[model samples]
Target: MRYLVDLGWLRSGLSFSFGEYFDPENTAFGVMRVCNDDLVAGGKGFGPHPHSDMEIVTVVLRGQVKHEDNLGNAEVTKEGQVQRMSAGSGIIHAEYNASESEELQFLQLWFMPRARGGAPSYETSSYEPSQMVNHLLPVVSHTGSEQVASINQDLTIYLSRLERGNELSFHQEAGRRVFLFVIEGELEVSGHVMETRDTARIQNEPHLQLAAKEDTKYMLIDLP
Candidate 1:
């Protein structure tokens, strides 16, 4: 997982095993695994890559990303858009910037699927920040009813674009884990001040409350 600190043509921060950073104990959080925050230089991006038995989700934070896959799904995902690709058996895909003069910033997440070896699939959607203001917008879920592509896990990704002075409260269930990733602005969680790209791994808590210190956009993973 990579999280960039500032806007730029190319930037990244890794949150898990990548390159020389390999901590076996810090590989994943529940079913949620890789979370990379990336900023791509215009006209540059990752080449074709292969993935298997994993759920790949991309959330565009700024600019646009061109996606092409073996499943014949090809499109440019703009800011506020989300794309999910299920590499059940296997799939090859590539991501590139959609503009020649503008940089692209995005978040890429990987989750462990409940079961393996099935046909791959792809889906995409968009969520405006205004719609998520001060509330949890249920984007990805195990069930497809929430408008996000269904994955093989009993979890949901809730996105919040909050305003200063507003708060978000959640009830934590037993045996469930919550992974919070701050995307923009600042938030106070469990006495910790989380800035952009900072994540909090929380579990065994009875309740949760996030107070926004500024207009904040973040993703909260409710995982079992």
Candidate 2:
């Protein structure tokens, strides 16, 4: 019912002093695709690039990033903020550090478009850290449910922060997959211990069980 992907086994790419860890061909997990954890150095970032037919979401874990796009959306995304962009027909955007003294740590995720081609759009939202403590805070979801960032796929992403002795529960759908990424601290998911940067890919289970071995921060992605 569950499979694990150690962060060590994933490929890492370094560009502009940034580290990008990802899986491409191995990305398919029931409509949800691409999960990338990226850390960028202070003062350096991704140049404007074009993409089409993909839904991209960026979750900032620490520090700040300045974002500029063809949709005329420009702002600095700080810790606790989520940025959602739909590269429908085509769009160009650039993400860079907003400060020269701090590094930017975040996750860049991509989902295959439900259908092909449309007008591009962007949105950003700030979620409180206290809101995610010991619980799953929905960051992005299909249909823009509950005021969260909208995506093109039937998937939902929740960020969780748990302290030692804390645990979180998630009921599973019959034919979906759940991917858990430990962004900080240590956790035991269904008896399997995972440290920072570790990940778990799960499917077919009736529910997910997780307990913090210590203070922990993580993300749970539920996809159809």
Quick one: best lDDT, which candidate? 1
Stretches of candidate 1 exceeding 4 Å from the true structure: 1-10
RMSD (Å) of each candidate, 1 decimal: 2.4, 5.0
Top-scoring candidate (TM-score): 1
Query: How does each model score on lDDT?
Result: 0.84, 0.79
TM-score of 2: 0.87
lDDT, candidate 2, 1-224, per-residue tens: 11233343232321111224233545456665666666677887879999889888889888898999988999998888899898999999998978787777778777777887978988887777898899899989887744488887788989989989999889998988888888889999878999988877798788678999999999999887
Residue 48 of model 2: what lDDT? 97
Per-residue lDDT of model 1, residues 21-56, tens digit only: 677877888888788788899998888999999988
The CA root-mean-square deviation of candidate 1, after full C-alpha superposition on the true structure, stands at 2.4
